[model samples]
Target: MKQDRHVSPSVINRLPRYYRFLRDLLGRGVTRISSKELAELMNVTASQIRQDLNCFGGFGQQGYGYNVELLHKEIGSILGVDRLTPAVLIGAGNLGKTLANQVNLSTRGFRLIGAFDKSPAIIGTDLVGLTVQNIDSLEAFCRRYNPKAAIICIPKEAAAAMAGDLISWGIVGFWNFSSYDFTQNHQGVTAVNVHLGDSVMTLSYLIKHMDGFQEEAETEDDA
Candidate 1:
């Protein structure tokens, strides 16, 4: 594994994919996997797989390959899956509610300790076992829970202010889906901006290009 502090973001992004695939292998009762086999499953070259894994540390043996469970545990440790990071959710709107209900934050290292919203209709209501508190109570709640991260699901206009408030309360990271670019304004905060519309547009572009590719292939076959 590469020991350098300046690991590329692309490598960082691929770590989660490796972790997920290892998890699936574990579920299937697979005991071990070679770099070549794993690479085939992930659709990457074996050398690339080795390079990415080397960024952390070598886990595989020369001929024995990697012990599936051990490698999975090591990758999970690297990814901080066991950190149980406390997090708060701002905005108890549709997206926020869906995330709370459907997503298992703990599986990914985060624990949802508080959920807040400005709307009186949402505030004081139960959201997936946690009561939605008034936005006015965010600071107090943050102080009490001491969350390390905040999940922003509010409108674009309100996201920045909400992020500022969370930052004041000692939040160091944000998972933002508000269509606002938090990192552009916040200099030192670790923010993951989720743009659903952009992802859908990308899918549309791929579908259009795929159709064009199929037409060209068919024409060549006809010739």
Candidate 2:
């Protein structure tokens, strides 16, 4: 199915969550589900689910709900989850090690073909089955594998230079965990800047306001 170019970014952002939920459904032997059922599971409204899926050329039926496997596959396809784009991690530090090892990169759209770091002590060490090559060897490795994506976990100071190097070296997609924002300069490239601190701070805000939010909702219902 062709993608809707006019789809909102908010809808696009929800695709991964939809894909994940559908995958879970498939794993649990759920062969079919209605929009209402799905919404209940996802903490959303049935109409919202219908609108979002419809934006992608609605695969559901009026009476039969959605075929779970088909919906999963379609959402996965839409997000390129199964593309297995060749990817590399640029930092072999604590965060990098966790991501490369703990995360199932292949199942989540990337294949971590290489890991790199600037430290001499870390060089030649094993990281998620790949040897930690010195950052100097990055270009040579890129030439050999021609990776389309890179996972940047290095420090903020190094991210700017690394982003330029990746773009010039033909890497088009980035999963950046550095404290730097790489999206500002790269106009056409696909970049997701993962600010770990920002996320935690945002979580703090939600936690701080949760009680008030629930009280407001309760008051609204009573009114």
Candidate 3:
């Protein structure tokens, strides 16, 4: 299906969660799902699901519901999750090591081709089955592996420099864990900032609101 070229970025963000849920439903032998079911699962209104689906071309009916397998495939293709993406991680610091150990890279369509660090002691060590290569090997790895993107886990001070280094070596996209504002010299490169503090603050707001809700519910029960 030919998708509309001008879909909103918010819609794009919702695709991954929708795709994951649809994939799960399919795996559980679910053939069809109502928009209401999706909306409840995703914490949105049924109309919202239907509208988003319609933005990418319709997938559901008024009463019969949507075909789970078809929705999964469409979302996968739209988000580029259907294809494998080669990636690398730089800086073997605490945060870097944490990210490395947290996920099994073999699943999830991400191939961790290599890791780099400036520490001489850590160089040549093994991390997540890939040997830790020195920062000097960055260009070589980019040439050999030709990864689509890289994760910058180095300190804030080193972020810009490492990003430039990656850019020099043909890394077109970056998942920047370092809190640095990047100035892109190349037209194709994209840098996504992953601010840990902002995420924590968001979680804190949720916790506070949930506590308030519980207090209100207790008062209502007393009444």
Q: How many residue pairs clash in each candidate?
A: 5, 0, 0
The positional error of residue 164 in candidate 3, measured at the CA in angstroms, is 2.8
Choose 2 or 3, whichever is better by lDDT: 2
Q: Between 1 and 3, whose lDDT is larger? A: 1
Worst 10 residues of 1 by lDDT: 200-209
Clashes of 3: 0
Model 2 residue runs over 4 Å out of place are: 1-82, 178-193, 199-223
| Residue clash pairs of candidate 3 | none
lDDT against the true structure, each candidate: 0.70, 0.71, 0.66
Tens digits of per-residue lDDT, candidate 3, 33-128, equal 899887888799988888788887877766799999988988877777536567788887777777778855435446576899989988888786
Determine the C-alpha RMSD for candidate 3 after optimal superposition of all C-alphas: 17.0
**Model 2 accuracy (lDDT, Cα):** 0.71
In terms of lDDT, model 1 sits at: 0.70
Q: Model 1: runs farther than 4 Å from truth? A: 1-82, 178-193, 199-223
76-123: candidate 1 lDDT, tens digit per residue: 787776676777888889989888887666644576778999998998
